[model samples]
Target: MIIKVPGSLSIGQVAESTGLSVHALRFYEQEGLFVNAVRRGPGGRRLYTQDDVDWLNVCIILRASGMPLTVLRRYAELVREGAGNAQERLALMREHQERVTAEIGRLTESLDLISFKVGVYEDLVDQGDAAVRQCHGPSLPDEARTPDLRHEAMAE
Candidate 1:
């Protein structure tokens, strides 16, 4: 029902291009999630320009990064309104940037703690010392064993 040009993509094409499903594309359109409303071709089929795909890519990333749908919609509205509001957009992005940075810092610290725990466990295996293993986390009993099951297999 529609004739598409080289640079224009149908809704199906846009879905494939954006890695979003047709239903998701329709929902995003309904939610006003895009910076520009999707265009329509001669018979009213949805036609997406390259810029639409690019915007959708950005929206996907933002959503993946945990931006709320409401915030995303606001950002789209600001972008669609065009120019003169770069500062507002920057402020919005900067806030999210700060949150992501803090989350990264927390995750890094957690990873370091995990690494330290792994190191402590490794020390038990390297020394094969039951007392040290007990002091670290587990009590050495006659039948007690380190959590690493490979030791049992190796002993067999």
Candidate 2:
């Protein structure tokens, strides 16, 4: 049984609505990231719907947040396979949630550090600290001070 969505969209329309390029959408399809197979129009052009675009937006967020493609593909496969694996899918999501939580923690910590640094700079600027005006100082670089959230997420 095939389920039809509310509105049909061309690849360009999907790309525009989802804020992804046509190439990225095609790459996502080639990467097995789609939960449902896209329908094709005459001449074998890819056709999408609002639901597909919405799902792709979720995929983009998950991918951007450092969820591995393998894990995403597993989730998609379970979804396509349907109801029996609901528990398993939930388990996978829960695990991913844990990882996301940890990443949020790291990011929060990084943000705190940045905020502290910014406050210190503000104080220095207000006080006219001569050292703060110099381009070269003993202060650590921003990248060095903060952990890489993407790497931290993938490490989990």
Candidate 3:
């Protein structure tokens, strides 16, 4: 969906382009998570710019990665303050990156386990293993059930 670059867009345009609800866009603004201040039209209706769309993309990524709103607000505040806090901003991003990396690792491991289980199921189905098909349960040994990476990560 070609986003117009030069002129301001209405709230509806921003919502449609970003795949976010109008209420959610308003919430993001009210929560101070947005970098740009939305301009108001003659009737005090919100008008968004291309910069707002760009910033919302960043916000969507950060939020989806499980970054807390407080952290996002702090990041937004850093941008608003402008200059001289590069180190602080870097640190914040680095910290979130670490968390995202950890989450990715956990998810990857879980996916691997699930894939292995699927393979086992496929093999059993092919072999016509009635017992395995009836059970449809995890093949993990009893001792392997506790304190594994998947359990620990999901418990968090």
Best candidate, lDDT: 3
Q: Which stretches of candidate 3 lie over 4 Å from their true place?
A: 1-5, 131-156
- RMSD, one per candidate, in order: 10.0, 7.8, 4.8
What shift in Å separates residue 90 of candidate 2 from its native position after superposition? 1.2
Ranking by lDDT: 3, 1, 2
TM-score of 2: 0.76
lDDT of 1 by residue, 84-147 (tens): 9999999999988887888776566545545656777687788786535332322334243333
lDDT of 3 at 113: 68
| Candidate 1 ranges beyond 4 A from true positions | 1-6, 118-156
Per-residue lDDT over 38-59 for candidate 2, one digit per residue giving the tens place of the 0 to 100 score = 9999999999977787788778
Better TM-score candidate (1, 2): 2
- Whole-structure CA lDDT of model 1: 0.76
Error of 1 at 101 (Å): 1.0
Residue 59, candidate 3: C-alpha displacement in angstroms: 0.5
| TM-score against truth, every candidate | 0.70, 0.76, 0.82
Estimate the overall C-alpha local distance difference test score of candidate 3: 0.81
Choose 2 or 3, whichever is better by TM-score: 3
The lDDT for every candidate, in the order shown, is 0.76, 0.75, 0.81
| Model 1 TM-score (2 dp) | 0.70
Better of 1 and 3 by lDDT: 3
Instruction: Looking at model 3, report the run of 10 residues with the lowest lDDT sum.
Output: 131-140
